[model samples]
Target: MRRNPLGRTGIEVSEFCLGTMTFGSQTPEDEAHAQMDRALEAGINFLDCAEMYPVNPVRAETVGLSEEIVGTWVARAGRRDAWVVATKHSGEGMRHVRGGAPITPDTIPVAVEGSLRRLKIDCIDLYQFHWPNRGSYHFRKNWRYDPSGQDRVETLAHMEDTLGALAREVERGTIRAFGLSNETAWGTAQWLRVAEAAGGPRAASIQNEYSLLARMADTDLAELCVNEDVGFLPFSPLAAGLLTGKYQGGAIPPGSRRSHVENLGGRITPRVFGAVAACHEVAGRFGLDPVQMALAWAARRPFVASAIFGATRLAQLEHALGAAEVVLSDELLAALDEVHRAHPMPY
Candidate 1:
């Protein structure tokens, strides 16, 4: 596996990151453990989790189950220093955590402590904010994303507040780096400016929905990452498995995300299937596996530090890991570009 710098944090992580969002739901603990073992054996050192995980069916009962499962593996394996662990702090609208309160200076220490206790680790390599306190355009909310209603003063003040708290955590050795999820270029720029002036920890990375089906990060965010040296952790590189060609012709497989999420987190639409067909056409035309082709394309993006993927079964994980060796050809790249131009935003 190829290693990439995690921004300027002096930490190197593998090109592929294993996502544990379904650790306790679609995947049991034993399966998740096996997935972790297989991923580590494949040289994937980046592991991503969150405070409020097991997201397939987000219930209060299963809020911290994913972290707990990962914690058990960490304790059982006793190889704490073998991988780079990344987790997130829940933000506003998370009803199960802190009474749906937004992330604040006071909540920072509490969230960090809870995550540390759950993951059974002394320190976190990358601590990310799951979403912005103000609001985010991610997860199919871009249609009604209204930034004009935001209060700039309060937003920047909140950024400064959280940055100071994170800086203290860094000084205390509870966390080594800070990052963001579902953040925009302007928001990330504000964070960088505040960190520079407040003497706080720099924003090391940004995790967002980026893949062949989702190309929102190919413009401003991509340029910002390149210029600022921020690691681009593209989450859901498979588009919730839409690009895998498993859900074609309205045939929903049993135990699949579509069976659980109905719309696959709002990814299912009349046009998205057409786009999927076009992508599969290109994949077939090149004699490549759709799964391997999608993963390889995502991992090779210009500003991508690592492409995050989640697997509910051992076979899924192994198949995704095969992309580490799959290389894309120039003609195939051109064909993909043609498909992208035809169906830019299917959803």
Candidate 2:
């Protein structure tokens, strides 16, 4: 696997990051362990997790179970030093985590302590804030998102506090780098501004939902990321398995995401089906697996440092990892671009 520098963090991670959001929910601990072993064997050193994960169903009881599973594997295999481990501190609205407390300088330490205790690691390679406290437009909520009401003073104050906490963690060796998730371009710029002025940690990356079906990152976000050297860690590069053509023609598999959430959180509209079918057609023309084609395309994006994807089964992980070696031709890339242009923002 080719490695890329994760922004200015001086940390090199694999082009493909193994996402562990399904560790305890769709995937059991044994399967998660096997998947980790297989990923490591495939030369994938970037492991991304969170404080509130295993979140397909996202129940109160199952929160943080994914981290525990990864912790067990890290403790048993003793490969903690071999891989770059990234995890997140949950923001408010998830009652199961820190009693739905808002992320602040005080709570930042508490969250880091909890994650360290669970993962049994001395330092998190990348400690990301899982969504902004002010609110985010991610997860299919861009339609109604209103950032106009955001208070700049309060938001910057919070950023300064959290950055101070992260600076302390960096000094204490509890975390090495910092990043963000579900953040807008403006929000990321503000963070960078505060970090530079206060001499705090700059966000090394931003994890968002980006795929052939979701091209929101192609505009301002891409420009900001490139100019600022903020690496892009795109989650759901497969669009929750929609681009793989497994759920084509409205045939939902028994254990698929569609079976749980009928539309996979507003991702399964009529327009989405057409976009997915177009991708499948392109894959056929190129004699490529749709899953591999999508993953490969995502990896080759300009500002994308790493693409994060989770697998519920060993076969799924193997199929996704196979894309690491599959190179897309110019014809395929052009065809994908055409499809993206036609069906941009399908959801």
Per-residue CA lDDT of model 1 for 1-347, tens digit only, reads 99999999999999999999999999999999999999999999999999999887889999999999999999999988877999999988999998899999999999999999999999999999999999999999998899999999999999999999999999999999999999999999999999999879999999999988899998789999999999999999999999998888887899998888889888888989999999999989888888989988988887989999999999999899889998899999999999999998887
Task: List runs of model 1 lying over 4 Å from the truth.
Answer: none
RMSD of each: 0.8, 1.0
C-alpha TM-score for every candidate: 0.99, 0.98
Residue by residue across 1-347, what tens digits does model 2's lDDT show?
98998999899999999999989988999999999999999999999999999877788998889999999998999888988999999988978888888898998889899899899899999999999999999988998998899899999999998899899999999999999999999999999999999977999999999999998999878999999999999999999989888888998999887787778988888898899999999898888888988998888798999999999999999989989988877888889999988888999
What is the alpha-carbon lDDT of model 2 when measured against the actual structure? 0.91
lDDT of 1: 0.93
Each model's lDDT comes to 0.93, 0.91
Could you tell me which 10 consecutive residues in candidate 2 have the lowest summed lDDT?
Answer: 255-264
